[model samples]
Target: MARVKQKGGLIGCGFFAHNHLHAWQEIEGAEIVALCDRDEKRLKEAGEKFGIANLYTDAAKMLASEKLDFVDIATTVATHRPLVELAAKAGVAVICQKPFAETLSDAQAMVDACKTADVPLMVHENFRWQSPIRAVRAVLDAGTLGDIFWGRVSFRSAYDVFSGQPYLATEERFIIQDLGIHILDIARFLFGDVAQLSATTRRVNPAIRGEDVATILLDHETGATSICDCSYATQQPEELFPQTLVEIDGSKGTLRLGANYQMIVHADGQTQTLDVSPKLHAWARRPWHNIQESVFNIERHWTDCLNSGHEPETSGADNLKTMALVFAAYESAAADQKAIDVRRMA
Candidate 1:
């Protein structure tokens, strides 16, 4: 028997919500039937652009009226807890943007809400879903990398992101909350959860309210060490704006993922290089295609899991570990590079 399309409503039609909407359009078994936002102008624009007529300026009204199977919350951190709880109370699944909450407590509340309601919740943590990153994970899982001991996940670029999301520059917590969260999650995906970690942060860009650069050292529970770093102040001739370069050293050999989605794996006395760049979807643009494709992939995974009675890879409960790392990085940075146990989020 063919299943009916799962009706989904999207909340917050801001900057990155367009990517979610575009990706949702490509996902099978899912249809965004409604839109919600406080900004009337943005709501009208997105409704017309996406051809979604069921729109609301208030989420409560939309939740009360729309019979949605899921709601994708693309709003900012400040609105995350309430929106997630609202969806949970309405008995709809939720997919929320990263930096899931401003604090660990708020993140916990949102996760708890979905658990209590017996609904699925996925954090929009899409970095690990990026194809190139998945390729590296495949090699590691195949034992081709052989007992990984050390690794580095880095994303450094000077792209003018503030032009689109101007509020990032004014946030008390910037890079770690904004960009480093992805890098840290990737480290967890490639390696494992952290036992302890320390970090150092810098505000190289005078214009931003928070630190624009950060370097973190993580001790994975699998007896591996990894470095996760991010910067918006880096300047290079070849600006790899959106690419995350990776290097991992294992008992057998080393693996390197460089610019242009090139991967070199040297193992078993042999070396091989492969191009792992993501395919550009019809609606996706370059540099962002990798990210956009991951959005589609994860969303499809969400619907599949929702149907199969399986939990998503980045489920709210699972993302709690990733969320802990984000908070630990900040605590370490503020404590003058003191090592912090990942278990103690405070």
Candidate 2:
């Protein structure tokens, strides 16, 4: 039997969208048949580079003309809700990029739209899909580290991200909104849903308009407390750019995911060290490869879910919790680091 590929259309040809485009090419059960971007130059360039023929400057025209099974929305936060709603209105499934909406109400509206349209909607929150992160998750699932009680998810680097995405430097909410969202999602992925959250932020980079550093404290529903901290201002001897380091302490023992993808687990009176690294795909580069591979992983998961009629692990409904944590962090920071009830916000 031949596998029928799901037809996909990609919107927003931007810096990070290229990774989505490249990863879609490698996906087994999906193909990006049409491209849409308001910028004609970027749309044409992406179509030429990827050998896509169907191109459009308007998304509605593309959605109405093409019989797409799903739309991969790689647009910025400002456009996510509209694009997702458009796709849902067309009865097409949607896989939108992270920071899925500007607010919880908007996120819920998008989710409701898809639900009413009977279409699957997934948020492309891919950090938890990284191979190294999955490895740590596997350990937890296998009961290797029993009864997780405490953890820390940290991503500290002095990398020059502005060189690639200059707009990030100008966002009113930088680290927590752009970077810490992923770290916070990972905390939820590893520990569980958050019940309470408190945070503090700092503007280390005077040139930027938003905070470049943030630390968040999460009280998980499972009674596990965790910290998610992200910084682009730290000048360290070893720069672990794009790498997420983790520490997990459980009833039996502890686990540490250090730099260079090193994961150490100690349990039952024994310590085990493992190398957990992401695969470098043909179209991926170093440092960014971890994230690139996760793009592939999550997209592959989308295709599988579409085929199997399974709800994605990071569906819009699920992402609301993560987004709640993001907003709650900001609220906490603004309120003098006071704890905010995450469930109420979500």
Root-mean-square deviation of each candidate, in angstroms?
1.0, 0.7
lDDT of 1: 0.93
**What local lDDT score does residue 238 receive in model 2, on the 0 to 100 scale?**
91
For residues 275-305, what per-residue lDDT tens digits would candidate 2 score against the true structure? 9989999999998999999999999999999
- Which candidate number would show the highest TM-score if scored against the true structure? 2
Worst ten in a row by lDDT for model 1 = 337-346
- Cα lDDT, model 1, residue 215: 99
lDDT value, residue 117 of candidate 2: 99
Error of 1 at 82 (Å): 0.6
Among these predictions, the greatest lDDT belongs to 2
TM-score against truth, every candidate:
0.98, 0.99
lDDT of each: 0.93, 0.95
